[model samples]
Target chain A: MTAQPTQTGKIIISVDAMGGDSGPGVVVAGIAKSAKKNPEVGFLLHGPKDVLSKLVSKRRVLDGRVVFRDCPDVVTMQDKPSQVVRSGKNTSMWSALESVRQGEAHGAVSCGNTGALMALSMMRLRKLPGVNRPAIAILWPSRNPQGFNVMLDVGADVRADAKDLLQFALMGASYARNGMELTRPRIGLLNVGTEEHKGRAELKEAHALITDFADQANFDFVGFVEGSDIPGDKADVIVTDGFTGNVAIKTGEGTASLIGDLLREAFKYSPLSRLASVLAITSLQRLKKRIDPRRVNGGVFLGLNGTVIKSHGGADATGVSAAIKLAFTLAKSGFAEKLAARVASTAELEQDAAQSALQTK
Target chain B: MTAQPTQTGKIIISVDAMGGDSGPGVVVAGIAKSAKKNPEVGFLLHGPKDVLSKLVSKRRVLDGRVVFRDCPDVVTMQDKPSQVVRSGKNTSMWSALESVRQGEAHGAVSCGNTGALMALSMMRLRKLPGVNRPAIAILWPSRNPQGFNVMLDVGADVRADAKDLLQFALMGASYARNGMELTRPRIGLLNVGTEEHKGRAELKEAHALITDFADQANFDFVGFVEGSDIPGDKADVIVTDGFTGNVAIKTGEGTASLIGDLLREAFKYSPLSRLASVLAITSLQRLKKRIDPRRVNGGVFLGLNGTVIKSHGGADATGVSAAIKLAFTLAKSGFAEKLAARVASTAELEQDAAQSALQTK
Candidate 1:
């Protein structure tokens, strides 16, 4: 592994090697692989130094791109978010996130428990100015050629009100613009229906708020959407409460896999089906690669002061490596800063609107 | 189609033929196939009389097992639940559900808009005693050889409190016991972690409430269970709020499909993988058939007065027919009455416990 220089000095991705289901072994391996591919990049692998060193010795590696930050403890999935952040001072996830916050690294990526990661990042780097609550922005494959669909507030706020939802929409819009390079991203609130009266009372209220903003702003707010509309390119950015958002993403992933399994089983039952599968195998593979959730390993936790990437807890080397690369891209794009600026101005605008309404009354 | 006699009186499954993505054509074909296997059953095919009659004419006879009820309008997937229920007076889905509610039919099934069905059911039949909200319960294949995993609150009660969750757990347990014939079914509350304090504050509180009731004479209440544990046979019944439950189920479905597709592609890419796929194909199909969501399409909306099953909105004929079968089973088994009695007693017991605790304090 060799260090590769980015135009902006150096692109360093701090890896929480001790995080995720497989621990530092896969994370370390992924970083090793990623480092070898990108010569100008460097990694600050935060974990137990001795263990990582032992693991690294078993594999082939040059040196400069790899380094270790000693973190004595690791955050378990079962631990409370506060406990993991406050009590586990020497945890790998915490240290890696801290490295990015303190500007020692350009960005950080963790395939750990999402709850703990969100809490620790908030407590360390903190939320950006005018951001009520940071959101977990995930890129899901839409039925369009434009890469993927970005949804936010996946596991950030459980009991979200109208205001929280509005903030989520704004944050997601900024991420789409800055990270995915989409201008005036069409934002849709994932509800039971597209009508104003379709969703819960909170959603209706949120719709009223965001619609007002969209009337004035550059962003395209496309009313409301349902669970089925997620796969379609109805909107580039989808926003919802963490609970619904999390379930929607998971459901889509689960259903897609289930259907694929069904198709495979059907194909195997007869010679004719098998012949058809053989013919369509290339196109099928391409579609699978495109829709694979593992390919989009890291989800940006939007509205934070610094870059906080949440990788899949069950990620393998390939997935974790993709997350590292994603974090590098997000950091370079300055998505966090863009979000902070937008949110700050939006909050001011909302306040002015409220004031005017009150004075007129 | 012919109606035959059973010990529990002649039960009819009224299916809305003009529902789902593929329409009544697939539904009629599926029902025809199912009816051939079970001649003792009866069906009331509700939709546009002309369209349904034309489709039915193409299918083989089931010895008078099939009938028809006319409905004028069809509800689209995008229609709001409330609006559809209110205005769709003569819709295929509405008429079928009404037949069940009015006791003209024992059960009804539709591959219609889910929100519309839920709204219509709640509006007509109303909630059961001691149950604030109704839950849609689906059976997923478990590692246990006995039956499938009973998951409740898939899309009912989005803003559920701890009390609401407790009600759902009890309802799910009762349904599992009566419908699935699992006595003393172990109930697990779905959370992010297995630990008591892992999830949101509400979940933590709900865990305490459930644990407190575990030692009582009701169903065996297990502690917290994670998303991954649901697939395993850790608990017979799993309960969560509608938002999380729906997502988890969807995620499970999608992820499963994704894995199968990946395997299919891999097998096609090489000779060795193809051989392995060939060897395991039969066993895999059997397993998949057992776990298919479409096969378990009829999810009972427990905590509602009378029997109302929510078939998946995107359900095909097989799924709709299965839902119809599920509804009949519930009706004949007298599950609604038994659950109502049990829940009434449980409510009384809870009130008594609260009174005693206050005296002690």
Candidate 2:
């Protein structure tokens, strides 16, 4: 609705206003909520300019805080990741990431298809120097003092070799430091058991490589962990290949959803139980808030040239706001810049490890 | 304890009494519960003679139904699987499997270390004629009419090829029919997405092979299903490789545990909330009972020559009984014999599929 002034000093996030299941209206509402809360945060919203303007008009709080980018095409969930990279230039998700790439926005946030977003981000922003495949990292609710643990490669590339895994450990450790403000993070490679000879061949190799890299990278290597330890207090960061990580997270989410649905059903069984539900509403709400997926709604793409956070495709207003808040915080912290510096040194060290491994053999 | 007379005509199961966290006392209690409930079921208990006899003597229901086997050694949870396969002869777990191998018991049940148990089963009983990898299938609580869905390769082996996955489909379907009594089970391959092109290379090959053999195998192929669909009402059988499957189930269990802990903490926050928890105890208990992991505690090893079930290593009396009941049901159904007949025809079909693919190329 208004021409944006020079907010070059402020942390401006490139927001994809389309592609999410809740549509652009909720996206506007989410950003408006964020803008009202943080004076230093602004948004470069990408969508159909006319449609987004009408939605923004209703939210007077976002009158001067938003800069609209007219992206005519919207990326659908059904679109293949490879196809989108070739011909999805005008899509809101693409435009949103482009703003960050072109230095028009500090970082980008999108509630879109995970595969497509990761593919587009890699192609547009390119990978960091030594990063073979980019990873998607998310904060899992945990028993730790930080309230959450980080798990990587949730749904990026489906494969990661020993060297790639070594990179993930470094990138993940860096993420913990910048994102969670932890000085030294505990890194664990996800396996079936905490045994030396357990899991796949690559895992065994990765375990050896990561153990060597941990001290140099300034993180504690908790050699191996099982799926249960992902949410447990054993490690602050759990690293696994994209395929396993994706299934594991989805399974966790599915189980949580099932428990919630079953609890609601339990509370509705009788008239007395229905009255008990009202009395326990506050208590149940507290439990829900603590484990709410929406509260920690951003999946940050690691090993990227720029900061990109992928919000849940079905995210509502609250979820979208959570993603926006995360992007703003990371952008302010200059997490991506610092991560690049850290990984730049990793290439030489990885090569030396490879050389030593070969020589020893 | 009274000596068992003629269990040759009964559904006698070889029970490993020394492995579970609760020890032989709970194992004895579990079989007593089973023996009391089902007069036809009996046990060939494997453990130290003196210890097992002392425990079983206390349970009057198992007086005539139990036969003691003197096994001096016990398989600890930390025992290496490979080492156990080579030299764990006198251990209770090995003795338990030997009974099934020698045709002295209809089936075998153990609460030993999973990897060790699987290794011993393969070494003692061997694989079926056409099956490459044996799978550990468990009943996952779902919203289906049967209230559970079968998921395979939970941790039998960490790797499986395309052919191995097709066999998993056949074996999982067979498990659904016998274990859950589903006539024609609907099978879905686990992946990150339902798209045919998604997931690792082996999954795509498995998808094509499973689809081709679905009709011949007498199971409905639901193409690809995501991790969320595991607990959903979509399919009766969900198949995946052991590595991914293991992570998924463990992740699901971990999330459930987290929610349970948080719910308990939430209820203790305030006096009113504590009062509300008391009024809602019945409702909460109902929810807990519906999804109790101990209630459905057996992980059946399919693609093996004989029936073997691996119970949770930490199982108490209730969990142990659940595994025993499952063993009794499968033993009575002659599920192993029926599955063998079905898989006998599969070897020829698989060979033909491979030949056709090679010729076409």
Candidate 3:
């Protein structure tokens, strides 16, 4: 590949332009809005040239910051992830990920098929050392000062063993350090109860594993956390299987929508009620923005070869653009490589600890 | 058993009055109200005589319809299930379950420790012929006229085999027939996706196993359902493991709370909006009442020799009262016997089907 435009110290984001429900139109619009404010950032659009050209022409101001590669094929949301990723190498999702793998872009963002992208990335880009399964780690709004907590394995691995969970904690910790700029993130396993022996066999095994690692000063591994702690933001990183994560996220989304409807009804009682509601509107709006899934639409698939961010398929232009910016920030953070190195070095600590225990016995 | 209190189609519900958050006060109150509405129902309150006497005195009007039996210890919410049930044979939860198992009561209700209740009931009542584990089946409110969909194995078997899921479906089908008054209930397996090849190994194996059963005329078993379908009431019975069920229910509860909060905020806009809200208040309240989980707090643990229902630990007086009424209704419903009979009758179908398939091959 020829030399692409560099943005000095700013992050370069390669986005799958022809992804999501509205395709490149929303993505391009979102990027246009984001690029105006973040001038230091650059975007590489991967999609059909004709579709993106029309959308780009409408937004004249986004000219310098954005560029495109005419990728013909687009991965549909319903497509079997493995089948398409293996055969359709020239698809927008694949092309965007290729940019990151080849070091042509700092990060890649897609609002298309998540499963396909993850499967493809894992097959193409080797997993991080000790990471049996790479996970989709995302930020969730919390009551904490950190704005939100990070959760992992949202849609990557359905059934995770002890080793997989350990890797999730590691990858999540790394993402928190880089993505959220946490110096040392507190990690916790999502369990039924807070007690040490309160979970299933896999969770129990995972707890012992993480605790053993924590003894070695590998990372800040906290104890088990309950389902209630997820929204409470008690831990910096919450690790769980993709099945549970998907359910939890969807439940949050559905519940948020339901509550919004309730609040609307509560304010319509009387004139005084309306006045009280008006007073609370700004504060409530701020809270809404905080918990809004759209605002935090982007998530990073950690333990992959490169920075691969997945945006919500239903995102509007604003959401798509925020995702692009988030991807750039994550890629430039240098957290992935740092995390890989940290994991590699600390792996021997576990082996050494096992040996010590045997000798002591 | 003291001449078996009115054996003429009268359902006798024996409740551990000391089981719930509100204790016998709420249970007695609920029984009083329900007895007034349905005189055919009889009640047996199992707990300490002194404690239950005070509660019964408060509802003295229904004294003729209810009787009190003395039992001592209570299973605390945090107790280890298996150990508690094994040791505490004369506890309130155990006595309540035993009353049903011994034919002294048709059904039993408890708002006490779920794990303890499940363990005690499973041990005391025993599983049906093919059922290795009993499942706690709950009714989740959906948008359909069927009122709600049933989710099973909510906390019975944490690590389930293919046989466990099929048995769950069979038990759930029987419940739908007896409790729901449907001749043949539509059953669906709770899974990530509908594809036969999707989900975990357990799900795949279960899916393949159920196909044989579904082919016969026992019940209409629909293939698979996602999380969204739980709220949609698309099927009569939805089957999943204890781990997934616990997470899904927690997510639903959390989501419902979030939605209730959102609706409270939505109507606080302006003066004209307040009047619009007034017009919509009745409809909204109607909607809230429909989705309120408190209405259906009691869940039956199916596939047991006796009928046992688990109420939420945090259930208040109204919620506790509902559980008592539900227990009484289910006792008369003859669900347990019908399920046992149905499974026994279908025993030959599987063997015959296998033989026929072999012959054809």
Candidate 4:
């Protein structure tokens, strides 16, 4: 494959070509698809040069936009997050993130072990100033007019104190604004019940803190929201600790897929139903497209010095392309820089809220 | 309404008729539906005698099997759990639970405030011996041959320690056995990841304790399961703290409904799609029935001294009847007594595991 000259004004995404369940070939193919649609997008692909070259050579769309780096090592799924951080210097994941840190790429995309990728990204790009814990934000298809809602802290860690939650609210607001193009996104704290007196102690404290910052942050604080409201129009951004958010998103995915599978089974039950299925195939396809998880396949790592999008480890070519598109959008919109400024501006207000909570206790 | 003598061998359920979102009419209609199908089922309906008599008189199937207690007070949804425990003696919710405690009914069903109902039940019936916390378990529709999987503590409380999780697992296993009739139910600890090393410290401890007790408890322990597995066939029962379980189940419900709404919108998008929808109406109805929330509407409060099923507050006749049927099945199967015995037998083992966890800490 011929190496292209670096385009001065293009949005360069550093792609980690190793560690995906479907292998680097799928990643390369996905980037080629994105490059064809997005003429302004370029790639600094990191993997074994020989392997990546062979794959990229097969895709004509990638000829003028791809640059390959020979990083022979790979991060295995079994590798612990701590082990990867300490010993994965030569791996493709490390190289991809390093390119972002060094300003060679605007952002990075990885379809690898989530824990390992998160660890490497944090170590390489560092957290934005005044942010306590970074969060993973994903767009959930919802009943809203926009057809998507943002939910954050989907598993960067298992815990979040009141301060971390306040930061999540701000970071999430910034993400919704940039990604969803909302001027004032509605933010809700995820709890067991929507009532004010429900949920854990930290969540209650976090609710108060977020309420205090809502006006200054320029987002509509919708108070406490139950899990059902996460996919409803009640809130554009739902904030929770990583543990709850992680479980909720996965459960939602699982339930939707189960229903889809059962619907197919119902259509195949008899000759009459099968005839109906054939006649209804086009309408079903439209419905399928509306709810397809692959259409929104990236989880953006928020509150970092630079943005990094984590594609599903087992994502196919279309899913990978979706992640690339997300990275390109965030980079072009300067989401990482805007989010940093949002969190930094609220640092004093968060400290005041914490002090008040401590005084009351 | 004509009064009748209490039957000698019928299974009577105490129904709290005052506080449902749809009022006593729906509850009375529901019990009448259940009574029509099962001659052995009866109801000790708790509400104002004059009001219930008018509703029962409208349902011909309820004529001979209904009995009413004149509890004029009602438990409002806004009543605090603590407040209800103190001053709810005259309320219909309290009367319904008291009947179960007094052995006048085999089990109880309530559609009032969850917090109020749970508080009254715990105070009245008390926790089973050696049970630290009682859980509310619900059957989630799934791909299992039995068509459902048991998940608990869907919200009796927001917290559960390692010992509490162990209790939930044992209780959930018993529920699966009695409710779904799995001889040796597969029990899984719900966590962020399926890997043993990938969650909170309490979850790790709970995993170890549940693993150790699996053999003696006569349930198969599937080490750790993620939210995706909640609706899958990998486990017959999924256990978690009430906070996580509550959020997960609600999130799953919300996602399913969102998809359902979107599917309808897709089918109505154009004349061609609308025509296709008409042809596929039968297949669509079959699919809808399979995933209807009303078909499995009850949340059974497990590990309590007596059984109590909490129906959805806004449940229609069909949903209320589903809850009644669940209560009836648990009563006939002797679920509460069996669960109490299981917990009593496991007391020594849980104590040992707690001690081990403490020593390790």
Candidate with best lDDT: 4
User: In DockQ terms, which candidate is top?
Assistant: 2
Q: What DockQ do the predictions score, one after another? A: 0.19, 0.79, 0.24, 0.74
Candidate 2 lDDT by residue in tens digits, B283-321: 889899889999999999998878899999888888899
Summarize candidate 2's per-residue lDDT along A180-206 as a digit string, tens digits.
999999998999888898999888888
CA lDDT, candidate 4, residue B211: 80
Candidate 3 runs further than 4 Å off: A1-5, A141-147, A181-184, A215-222, A251-288, A353-361, B1-3, B6-10, B182-184, B215-218, B259-284, B351-361
lDDT of 3 at A28: 87
Residue-wise C-alpha lDDT for candidate 3, range B207-299, written one tens digit per residue = 766767875646787888777667654678888887777667776776566445544555555554455446556656766776778888888
Off by over 4 Å in 4: A1-5, A357-361, B1-5, B356-361
Candidate 1 per-residue lDDT over residues A222-313, each given as its tens digit: 98876655655678888888766765665455456545555677667677557656655665567678777778888888877778788899
Model 4, B1-361: lDDT tens digits are 1112266678889999989899998998899889999999999999999999999998898877988889989999999999999998899999999888888898999999999999999999999989888999998988899988999999999999999999999999988888888999999899999887899999998888888788889999988999998999899999999999999999999999988887888778778777767777888898888788898999999878889999999899899999999998988898888888889888988788778756765
- Location of the lowest summed lDDT over 10 successive residues in candidate 3 chain B: B1-10
At residue A105, candidate 4 shows an lDDT of 87
